[model samples]
Target: MNPKVRNLSTEVLSDNWYILRKVTFEWQKKNGEWQKQSREAYDRGNGATILLYNNTSKTVILTRQFRIPTYVNGNESGMLIEACAGLLDKDNPEDCIKRETEEETGYHINQVHKVFEAYMSPGSVTEILYFFVAEYTKDQKVTEGGGVTDEEDIDVLELDFSKAMKMAQNGEIKDGKTIMLLQYAQINQLIKYN
Candidate 1:
């Protein structure tokens, strides 16, 4: 059983919010054979995503933004409803998510429980997403969100559990990480269905 990486080649595919690269790797398989596999790897940018829940209000904080990819692909408006998420420049997942949550929804989440980590699009992109769930309250302070001028345009949204579930069922929520986190929260009873 021999496993070794031989060579790697990368080519730029796009340069939007995040740079996309098609990566090809040559490797030696365990059976002592050489193979090549290509994957679209997103540059490892510092990014974090989190779901904010207010159990008392039975509501969750989300964001709506226009996604170019979704728009160009098939979505009517290309608008994506998702949890608060952003790239981490100098912070860990927890810190990054907290900051993003605050910046996107004015909710300061102090305690965050890690759900899981996943690759948003492994086959074609290399974006590793860290997912988390945090508890907030109706009394939690709220303010206008959306970051600096360069990255402004985010609209904050709050939805009750039932509404969010309905959106998920109706296929309105298309972001993979958000879907996964919401489903996870539902299955774990962290969030009520109604």
Candidate 2:
């Protein structure tokens, strides 16, 4: 809710997987003038992402997958390396990350610490991503996580935390969520850089 703006009308442009709406509104200017405008917004439900780290091993788990949007935009391979993440459908953020971690990476992990949450793309997409961090040991791996059959093709990668950070810094890991989490890990001292 904003005091300087009044929402007028909205029209649904697409509502298949997620809702996309075009909204018309009036905003009061600083000089006391009213301006009318229209903007399209995407309303995908919020999601959660987690960084799985092994303090003893000094490594972290990440995933690689094909992202159509990235390919369409400019990426030649259309593949991206990202942290374990999923939409918060019926479960809370914590539970969603736990499920996603196992489903996408095959690690059955508990005891996650919520780091922070953010709106990934505020200008258009209305997706608030909840960020989390959890410690993982080799024994907790219960399945060969590569995503569900015919659903997601994910390549699970366990890399040295230092290498992961360098990849993020050098554009090898281009996913924003993954980059953010890796930086957070360093700033918060989740893992020491070599």
Please give the clash total of every predicted structure, in order: 4, 0
lDDT (tens digit, per residue) of candidate 1 on 1-194:
33487678789897886788888888887788989998776675857888888777788888999888898898989899998899888789898888888888887678999888987766755668888999987656566777645756898888997789789889988787788878887888887544
User: Can you give the TM-score per candidate against the true fold?
Assistant: 0.86, 0.96
Query: Worst 10-residue stretch by lDDT in candidate 1?
Result: 139-148
Query: Which prediction has the highest TM-score against the true structure?
Result: 2
- TM value for model 2: 0.96
Q: What is the C-alpha lDDT of each candidate?
A: 0.82, 0.94
**Model 2: per-residue lDDT, tens digit, 7-123?**
689999999989999999999999999999999999989999999999889999999999999999999999999999999998999999999999999999979999889999999
Residue 140 in model 1: lDDT: 63
Best by lDDT: 2
Instruction: Estimate the overall C-alpha local distance difference test score of candidate 2.
Output: 0.94
